[model samples]
Target: MVENKHVLEISSVTTSDRGVYTCKASNRFGADICQAEMAIIDKPHFIKVVKGTNTVLQCEVAGTGPFEISWYKDKKQIRSSKKYRLTSQKAVISLEVSSFNSADVGEYECVIANEVGKCMCSATYILKDWQTPLIS
Candidate 1:
C-alpha cells in the first residue's frame, strides 16, 4: 500500500497569480484528479495625474465582482459633493477634485473589497506651490 498528500500555499496574491490549477494522484490501480481556479484580490494603486492642476485621482483594481470601493483622506471617509466627485467604472475608481488647494494635501487611501477578500492602498498628496509640480 502507498499513501501521498500535497498542499499548496500562496502569499500576497496578485493579479498575476490568477489561473487554473490542477492536482492529480495516480497509483497502480487507477488515477484521481481535481482542479480549481485561483482568483486574486488585487490591491488598489493610484494612476498618474497632471501636475499643479485640478486633476482626478484614479486607482485601478482587478478581481472578482461585485466589488465595493471607498475613499478616505487623512483616515477620514470621503463622500461625493460639490468639491469632490467619486466615480467607479468596472475595475477603475476615481475621485475628482474641483480645485487644488492646501487643504487637499494629505494621505489619500482607496479601499476595495469583495466577497472573497479586501485590500487597500494609499498615497500622500503634497503641494509645494501653485507653480510647482503636483506630487502624490
Candidate 2:
C-alpha cells in the first residue's frame, strides 16, 4: 500500500463558480481525468414601470439557461396574447401590457426555471386615483 489518503475540497462558491471543473492525475503508465459542471439558479427581480400607460413589466433574471419564463396575474398563469406581449433576451424577460388600465391594477409575478431549479418574484401595480369630495 502507498498510503490511502486523498482530499478535494471547495472552500467557497459564487456565481463565478458556475463552470466546468476538471482534475487530472498521471503516472508513468497510467493517466486519469474527470470533469463536472456547476450551474447557478437565481431568482427574478422586479423592474420599475409607469402605470396607466403602455408599459412593459420587466423581469430581470440571472441564472443558467435555456430557461422557461412565465408571467402570473393574481396567482394565475398568463399566456402570451396580442394585448400581452412576452419577450425575452438573455437574462431579461418582459411582459408588455398595452394601455394599462384600472383593471390591470393587481399583483404580478415573474417565474423562471431551468433543469436545475425554479425561482420567482412579484410586484404590485397600484394606481392612486382620487375621487371628488362633496359637501351638502
Q: Estimate the lDDT of model 1.
A: 0.74
lDDT of 2 by residue, 1-136 (tens): 6975556676776677788888787889999988888776553333442222335666666665778888898898888887688888776678777666676777887788777778777767765553221111
Summarize candidate 1's per-residue lDDT along 1-136 as a digit string, tens digits.
6755688888877688889999998889999899999867554443433222345677767666788788898999999999888998876788876766778888877788877777787767777686332556
Residue runs of model 2 more than 4 Å from their true location after superposition: 18-54, 130-136
Candidate 1 wrongly placed segments (more than 4 Å): 1-54, 130-133
Cα deviation of 100, candidate 2, in Å: 2.1
Model 2, C-alpha of 10: deviation from truth (Å): 0.8
The lDDT, on a scale of 0 to 1, for candidate 2 is: 0.68
User: All candidates' lDDT scores?
Assistant: 0.74, 0.68
Worst 10 residues of 1 by lDDT: 44-53
Error of 1 at 12 (Å): 14
